[model samples]
Target: MNNFTKIQDKLMEMGASFVGCSDVEAYLPENLKKVKYAITVGVRLSDFIIDQISDKPTYTYFHHYRAVNTLIDQITLRGQIEIQNMGYSAMAVPASQTVNDLEDRYSGVFQHKTAAVKAGLGWIGKNGLFISTKYGPRVRLGTILTDMELPIGSHVVRDGCGSCRICVDSCPAMALTGNSWFAGCDRSHIVDAQACSEYMNRNFKHIGRGSVCGICIRVCPKGFSK
Candidate 1:
């Protein structure tokens, strides 16, 4: 097997629900073409998410974000170290990189999502979400940018959402109808960040409060509860 395959297997054994690699070159967002290599990382969610829910101030959903960030941090550090050992220059890019750079230094492309989809980790669902076999759409993602050259993987050719509209029908913000073209804002059918932001801004009781109503997550038959 190639280094990419070996790394992918190693990641899966390390507790990753899914793993994939792609040639960032092909999908190079014009702004980020300077990047020679891109690594996409993802972690599956568990019922641990349910346990972190609260009705208190700020309605913290800490475990989910924490778990995701932890995975991203560990995997990124490990990968970067390995790259350097192999004589390559590598760097970790936070999700915030897109925001920090804004233009020349960054690409509008969300690296994690792009790398994941291109690696065949999942399909870009009609809901505009990446749906993987083990986690459906319940997962957190991150990416790394490097100058390392490695074997590439194929993109997920089949969409898991053959005919499912649960996400569309379950959107509380009435933000979904179809694909990214009509479904909702920012390419997610289940989330209307705008409506949610507006609601959270105006309403007092729930304006700043609990679990962010994951009705779509709860309703997805293919999704995992734990």
Candidate 2:
């Protein structure tokens, strides 16, 4: 198999639920501009656990969230090593990390959704989460930025949520703006990050140190079979 297929196959073997590549030169920050391509990975979360989430996040969900993030980090690290073995430079973006110094307190070093969307994986939801074509927002994403040219995913999926507001009305924090997300729109247009963070910190600090609230993921009907 060629390098692209080889890399993809290895990531799949490493437990990635879905994988895709995209040319993300336009989306990279100045420091990351050297790597013009991105390999995005998504891992599906437990339906049983997510379904149990109601007005508050459960301890089980909190543990599951951290476990998934750890798995993403491991898979992305392996992906990075595989790319480097093939004589290309690669950087694995952390599965879940907030760069507090950035102007956006809720932001990370890079937005995995940016690469995932560009890779034709999914569209951003009204809840401000990546809605994977196969799993909706019930998935966690990992990314590896690379300089190696690779096959890019096409057929970008459009917003599947048309007039649906379950996630919006279900947000305990009332942070969702009930606005549909379009490409190139600011995140602030759909959700208030400050409000969401503050609410979580105020009410759920005992759960996951106020870092997680999966009510939106639980109420989303896009990926539900029931």
Query: Against the true structure, what is each candidate's TM-score?
Result: 0.72, 0.97
**How does residue 96 of candidate 1 score in lDDT?**
29
CA RMSD per model (angstroms): 4.9, 1.0
| Cα-lDDT of candidate 2 | 0.91
Query: How many clashes does the backbone of model 1 have?
Result: 3
Off by more than 4 A, model 2: none
Q: What is the lDDT for 176 in model 2?
A: 97
Backbone N/Cα/C clashes per model? 3, 0
Model 1 root mean square deviation, Cα atoms: 4.9
State the displacement of the C-alpha of residue 222, model 1, in Å, after optimal TM-score superposition: 2.2
Looking at model 1, residue 67 earns an lDDT score of: 55
Model 1 alpha-carbon drift over 4 Å, by segment: 1-15, 29-31, 48-60, 95-109, 180-193, 196-213
lDDT: worst 10-residue window of model 1: 50-59
Best by TM-score: 2
